[model samples]
Target: MARAQREIGAALLEVTRHADVPSEALRDDGLIEAIPELAALGETPQDPHWHPEGDVLVHSLWAADLAASHALEHDLDADRRQLLVTASLFHDVGKPQTTRRMNGRISSHGHAERGGEVFRAMGRRLALPRPLVDAVAAIVETHMAHLSVRGDPSPRAVRRLQHRLAAAGTSLDDWGIVVRCDGEARGPAARPDASQPWRRVAARLQ
Candidate 1:
């Protein structure tokens, strides 16, 4: 494993294991400075209607924490677990750039694809393995595909997403995990209603 990968994996695992709290390792290692997108999240505001929790940074870590718990429940292997954790961390990297107030609501339109592009560059800069980087970026880019399914519910759409996942060396299972975690991070007020249907479709494809 790349050193950058191991360091991030360990830091995220610690955060995920400890109820999403910022671990000492992360602070001491200067991960925030190393990953500026994370620092930017602190300044980005989220609409309370959706994110009753707080800023994008808070939501990202919270989601990663949830993902870690789910990974344990499912007994995911280290690689899959790491991928989920990493994707969760990078999931909203574009929010700082894409977030905007529209109709009295904060929206991050196209943030997923924007985030994916940011991660691809960041991953390369950090010297992360090419396949791992691409896979994580793929998951981030397509994370919102499930929401479309909630509205459309088309098998063709599902198949198209599946092909994309395969091309990136990931699977529907991995994509679904990130989506569910991201949706649930809003806390109970904004429950993952849409995610449930998406999960059903993803489950069939998996």
Candidate 2:
């Protein structure tokens, strides 16, 4: 097997074997294992406009921390909240396998696609329910949409996402929360204020 697939396969086996935690806890651990790939893609120093470090892992974890914390404050149901936290944590797990060099810096240009594949494989290895695994994979694939939205999001993009949301149902909100958290954890200057967006979305759903 390829090294990346091997690593993910091993990790999934380990998680499944030692999944002694509550279902929720196991979800958290699974997410942690999945996100290092985001760093591999150079989504680290999340504030791409101004970042000092080349460590994608550090950047990814910081975003995860910020994202999870933000998700905890809302008036979400238990499962949905867990979904948010889990998605935020695993949003970039495919990074380590997709590392590359660009413009005198490191980046993982195709990390999202790579990570999605890794996530799908890992989900199968772990025997995750198809619905749950699919949700996680979709979140990984679409995590970068927010960056585009920050610029000039095309109607096509929004419609595409809306279609995805319609199909995924409640879980789609989890991806949205992850996206918001990603923006906030990027950097001091670039972090968008998540409170309002969180409230708007949360209220609309309720």
Candidate 3:
């Protein structure tokens, strides 16, 4: 199982590094099939108002694209860039199991926390490095913090989020990139001002 997980991880890494990874590759290369958790994302519904892209899988792909583009534009180191891309791919891995309808709206309450668990489990199953696994899980766990901060641009909230991520072994620099890419992938329903609060958080961190 360990060996199989390593092979799977390697394949996923290659797919993410491609300049133009087709959505088909996700299925063709067995990424979606071999990983049941990822496969389940296809059936996960999201709030259309927040995710015009339709489903969790589509949104995740868009996020991965944004992550890849940003990594190249910023000239990030290879390993760091790969980390961002991988995290983007699994950022919403738990949405399928967590989705629920509330007040005539779709919501994935605690999806981030659930996603962190899934990410950590995959990392351990794949025998990835401890640091890498922990970093990715930390990013998934706090992926929603940026949106919350956007809704309420309070300095106290920003500081608290920063402290939370720092304690979880994620840097503000990496967190900023992930959050910005996530917002950019929200399709037509995305708000231009969504990144502003994160920008302020970045400044505070510096």
Which candidate comes out best when scored by TM-score?
Answer: 3
Candidate whose lDDT is highest: 3
Give the Cα-based TM-score of candidate 1 against the true structure: 0.83
Query: Once model 2 is optimally superposed onto the true structure by TM-score, how far is the C-alpha of residue 165 displaced, in angstroms?
Result: 3.3
| Candidate-wise lDDT, in order | 0.76, 0.55, 0.77
Q: Order candidates by TM-score, high to low.
A: 3, 1, 2
List ranges where model 2 is wrong by over 4 Å: 1-54, 148-152, 169-172, 187-189, 193-206
The per-prediction tally of clashing pairs is: 0, 10, 0
True-vs-predicted CA distance for residue 144, candidate 2, Å: 0.9
lDDT per residue, candidate 2, 162-189, as tens digits?
5675575434456667777666655644
Task: List, residue by residue over 1-206, the lDDT tens digit for candidate 3.
Answer: 43387888777767666644535567687678777777788889899988988899888888887888788887887777777887888889879878999999999989999999988888877667677778888889888776663254677776776777777667766777777777778878765645466666557756
RMSD of 1: 4.0
Clashing pairs in 2: 34-93, 35-93, 37-93, 37-94, 37-95, 37-96, 38-92, 38-95, 40-95, 41-108
Model 1, span 70-93: residue lDDT tens: 878888776777778778877898
For candidate 1, give the lDDT: 0.76
